[model samples]
Structures are given as C-alpha cells and as structure tokens.
Target: MGPKTYSWPVATFDPLILKQPRWILAIVVGVVITLAFVRLGFWQLDRLDERRVANTTSEARMSEPGRPREGVLGEHGQEVNEMLHRATSVEGAFRTADEFFSPGRVVSDRQGTLVATPLDLADGTVLIVVRGIVPPGTPGPPAAGFEPPSGSVALVGRIDDGEKPIPIGEHVPEDGHLASLSRVDLAYIDRWIEGDVLPITLILEEQTPPDPGGVPLRIPREELTEGSHLGYAIQWFSFAIIVAVGVAVLVYRAGTRAGPTEAFPDGASRL
Candidate 1:
C-alpha cells in the first residue's frame, strides 16, 4: 500500500466578535465596573458637603455667649429649632436621689463620666441637667464635688437634645449603675424618672457656687475633620478614573485584532 498522508490546517486570528472569548460578557462586565466606581465617587462628594455644613454650624454656636434658658425652653417645651447647643443659665435645686451617671466620658484629656441629674425648677417642672464630668468608675449617687449644691442654684450650660438611647428591648441599664449605655434618651428615661422633666438637657458650663469641678465647658467632637473625608473622596474618584481607563484599553485591544489594528475580533471575515 502507498504511504498514507494526513494534513492539518494552520490557525489564524478571526476578526469576529462572536468568536472571541466572552466578548458580550466582557462589555457587560466593563460597563458594570465603570458604573459602580462612578457611584462610589459621587457618594464621597455628598458626605464631604455634609461635614462642611456641620462644622460651620458648630463654629457659629461657639462664637456666641449664653442665651436665656426660659427663652429657649418655654412652657410648650424646648423650642427645638433654637435650643441645640445654645448656652444658657438655669436656676433650680438638685434632686440627688434622681441623679444618674452616664459612664464612659472624656474630660481634660482624660477618661471620665457625666453626671446626669434632675433639677427641680422654680416653676415646679424638673429639668435634666448634665451636672458635669467626674472621673469614670464612680458609683451612682455622685460624691460632693460632682454633685449639685443644695438650695437654689443658678448655673450655665449649653442646651442640647440628649442622645437617643438604645431601643427598649436591646438595652437593660444596670440597677444603681448606668454603664455601657449609648445616648441619654429623654422619652425612654422619662418612663422610669419622676417629675415633669424638660425636653432638652443642659451640658454643665458654669455654676455660681464652687466650680463645677469639671473641666471648662467645651464641645466634644462628634465628626472628624473634612480633610479626612476629602482625602477619601479623592481616592474614590481616582478609582473610578482607573476603571474607565482600563475599560477603554480592553475595548481597543479587542477591536484591533492585528498586532496594532485590524477590526473587531468575532466571526470569520471575507477577503
């Protein structure tokens, strides 16, 4: 028998998109990646704006002197719009038994706690006043310096809405001790508290008698400077830009089937 022969055809690149590896999938993936990054970039910008507004409000409040408490907190309840962070003077007698301590606070560059005591006002209404800061780990029923003075006392502090407390089922405050708590919720605490308490709470600033025994009154920072937010925003935008550039490069490579340029890589092309 004559020698048998076998032949195989040479392989060549096809300029047909359909034949290409997951060409449709590639386009979809590219669009998704690009859009996701774009969304993140926009989110950062929004957060940056919020931070600026908050800081401005704080600075404005700090610049002014104390306002009158009655004017800010009328009989109808706290004038919500004008009371937050408004420094004011209040006169009342301390209800020591009703005093509760908010543990975990920082003062004078040191760890401490807050004295949340009720004050019996002249109008027979009770007001929640954060007496002042005391070293943390102090048991309930505050000691001398941290306690409010007996008899009539006029003190100054910034009126603020107490923080919201943990929801009813989530938190159970320890008896004779208030620890591991989050905020000073008026509605929640009012249930167990006595007397007609004011809606807003006072951050102890100054008292007529011996000093408050607390460091000078000042705002505790709740949010970080915008500089950090700005930095993060820039990073998000950078990521988006990178994703866009990568998509462009991929599309270009896929379209040009030749070493540098040809056409879309798909089905076979006619000569």
Candidate 2:
C-alpha cells in the first residue's frame, strides 16, 4: 500500500470569538486596569508640576533682602503657606519660662530636639521661634547657656508654618512646659503663651547677639528637590502598557484554541 497521509486540525484565530461573554469580560477588566494606571501616572505628573512651582517660589523669596517682622506679617489674609521660606527679621525677647522641646528632630543626620520658645514681638503678637536643635535628651531649658538669650534681641529666620496636631497621648504637659513633642503644633503650645500667637513660626537662622557657647547647633536651610514622583510616574505608565499588551496576547491565544463548535476540516464543521 502507498504511504498513508494523516490530517490534523489547524488552529485559527477568529475575531468573533472575542465577542463571547468570557473574552468580553476579560477585555473590559483589562481596559479598566490600564486606564486606572494611566490616571495614576498623570496624577504624579501633576504633583511634579506643583513641586516645581513651589521650588521656584522658595528660591525667589529666600534670595530677596529680609523683610521686617511687620512687613512679613502685615499682609492681611496671607496664608502661612504663601509666606513660607521667606526671610524675615523680628526683635523680641524670648519667654524662656514657656519654652518646650520637640523630640526626634534631626540636623545633619544627628538626632536632636528642637527648642521651641515664644518670642514677645514688638507688636505684642507672640511668635514661636524654633531656636535650633539641641542634644536629643536635653529637656526643659537646655541646661544653662543653651537657654534662650535674656533681654531684647533681634533675630533673622525663615518663615515656617505650624505642624498639624498629633494625638494628645503623645503631647502631655509638664510643669507649664512640654518635655517633648512629636511636632511643633502651636495650638497646643498656645496655652503657655499670653495674647494672640502668630499662626506661623520662625526657623531661627541668626541672632544679633550670638550665644558664645553655641550649645544648640544651628540647623541648615532645607534644600528643595523633586522627589520620586517622576520615577513613580514612569513605573505606572509602564504597567499600563504591559497590561494592554498582555491582554491582547491572551485574547489571541484563547480565540485560536479549540472551542465546542468550530470548523476543522476543509468545508467541514466539528460537532
């Protein structure tokens, strides 16, 4: 007998197969996931733009000549965010008796505490001044010379806003002063100061009369830099593309595979 020939069914993809309920559901799910990832990428881009604008504003404000305390605070209705990082000077006497400390502060990678003291401004409005960073464990008054200078003094600092208050459990008071705080939440510190306290605080940069001992180390101005937003955006965009291509490949494979009712042999249909 002559050599026998065998016939085998060949796989073929049909676009109509994608219309089936399962494929349709898969396609819809894939599309939704892809769109969500794309939206997240754009959100990160928006964050980047905001950061850039903030950096520009900070650079411009910090470079200009320092404004007097009144000039910085006199602008009616100006929010603390708007004035942040701007250079300003104020003449006041430190109310040492009411000083408190914010622990877990870091300067040059060294753990420390921020000495927060209320300054009696010339206009009678109290201003919270973050004198500087003291050793981590130093509580109430910073041990002698590190104490806020006595009498009237002039100070130069950058404008900063108060931090949001944390749970009261972490902010217990001690002898009219807080031994430590999680942040400089002025609202909680307001109890120690008399009269109206400004909504902002100063990151003390310089004082007319320097403390010879320099117990509390001066903190450097924070450097502005774009964070991981761009990288995160790229990752999200990549995920979207991957999901799109993966879905397409899966649909093609599924459609080409054999189904219950399909055409196999030439001009013949499988039962």
Candidate 3:
C-alpha cells in the first residue's frame, strides 16, 4: 500500500454551531428534553412488558395442575407469591359457623356476594376459602339454600391474593346469616378467626357434594385486557422525534439565512 492513510474522525455536532453561539443553548435544551422523553417512552415499554409477562404467567399457572396446599403454602404462608392464580388442592373441613360474605361481587354480569369460609387444616392452621358466589336473587342471612359441606371435604381452587381492604366497619355476623364482609382482606379475616391465618384465598373450582343449584361454581376468569401503556409509549417517542425534527429545521434555517446586517448605516447607504 502507498503511505498508510489515516482516516480522521468525522464531526458529529454541527461545525457551524460555533458561529451561532446562541444555538448552543437551544441544542443543549433540545437534547436534554429529547432524552427525557425517549427515556420515558422506554420506561413505559418496560412496564408493558412486565404486565404482559405477569398476565401470561398467571394464566398459564391457572391452567396447569395444582400443587399440594401444604408444599406450596407451607407454615409461614404467602411464600410463593409469584405462584398466584396457580391451582391447588386442600383437604379440610369447612367452618360454616364462621362463614363470611364478601359483599358487592359480580359474576356473569349479575351482581352477588362471595361466600368465604375457613378451612381448618389438620395442623391447626386456618385457611380462608372463598367457597362460591350467591346470585343476586338469593336473599341474605343463611344464603337461601347454600350451605358448606359437613365433615371432611376436599377442594380444588386457584390461588388468589387476599382482597384489598375496602372502607367498611366491623359488623358481627348474625346467628344464621353470613357476616357481610366488605372485602376478603387478611386483616378482616383475622377478625373472624383466632391466631395466625393463611395470607391467601382460594376461589372455589371444584368442591365435593356439589350444590350446583344453590351456589354456582365460580371459576377463575383471566382478565386479558391489554392496557394503554404501548400507546402512551408511542406518544412519548413521537413527541421526542418531533422535537428532534424541529431542531434540525432550525439548524437548516440558520445555515441558509442571509448574513447579519449592520444595526446603524450612513445616510447615503440608508437611502
């Protein structure tokens, strides 16, 4: 090869920028704002990905075979939080005497209440199980014809995060009627039972001695509604691009504009 040629690095920033010192401030501001918007767009996309993964995992877990209640739940409880919505089986007797009614739950478009009863395990640990839903037509107190099975029972249900606390005061359940609990919050469950209780709730899928007519089997339904995060991310990125394009147009205008003129001129030149 002839003398080794050295390729000089190309200048990325505008060379004419030094001539128009004021443009330095505009460019800096534009870059900062653009970066901020771009980062926000990426953050929203990350959130979208996380939400999608969570929903998909939950759906998959719900469909797969359930794990043993003791193995997953353990003694400390709420250990396998990532396994939410996973199906599981429990062997215990329903404590109908301390049955709780979660008010204002809707199923299949019709409004109703969820029957939450404690399942006293052999190891003395109490688990709150949401047995099923009572239809809107069913009257309160005794839940019409619905009653939990007597003696030992085996249940299959999907794992659930205990209900979020609703704004409601404590109300004692009557002798025959189920207690009107505003939500299935663990704090509320503690009020109904003594000592430590399981931190999760099971939405009844299959229960022995079926009462199909009395309490309809409430299967867990997945909410597949994709949120507007993707749209929001697009909007942010578009805004950043628009701002960048505006900066480019500004630089182009500066390059093409005529040279600066004198502020003051002689009388002859003024004419």
Tens digit per residue, CA lDDT, model 3, 1-271:
4443333233244457547768887888889999999999999999999889987887787678877787666642656576588788889887777776766788767677777788888888788888777876566434668877688888888888787875665566665343677777887668557646877878788888665347654745657655998999999999999999999778766665444453332232332
lDDT at position 37, candidate 2: 100
Q: Is candidate 1 or candidate 2 better by lDDT?
A: 2
Q: State each model's C-alpha RMSD to the native.
A: 8.5, 5.0, 10.8
How do the candidates rank by lDDT, highest first?
Answer: 2, 3, 1
Give candidate 3's root-mean-square deviation (CA, Å).
10.8
User: lDDT per residue, candidate 2, 221-261, as tens digits?
Assistant: 88999999999999999999999999999999877855444
Which candidate comes out best when scored by TM-score?
2
Model 3 segments more than 4 A misplaced:
1-29, 74-78, 166-178, 224-226, 247-271
Stretches off by above 4 angstroms in model 1 are 1-21, 74-81, 167-182, 211-224, 259-271
Q: Give each model's whole-structure lDDT.
A: 0.67, 0.81, 0.74
Off by over 4 Å in 2: 1-11, 76-78, 167-169, 174-176, 257-271
lDDT for position 79 in model 1: 65
- How many backbone collisions does model 2 have? 0
Worst 10 residues of 1 by lDDT: 257-266
lDDT of 1 by residue, 1-271 (tens): 6444433333344457545668767767877887787777678788889878877786677567876777655632546645676678888888877777666777657776666778889888888877656666665555445555677888888777888666563266557333334467777666657768778888776777744553323435344367666677778778778877887676666665434333433443424
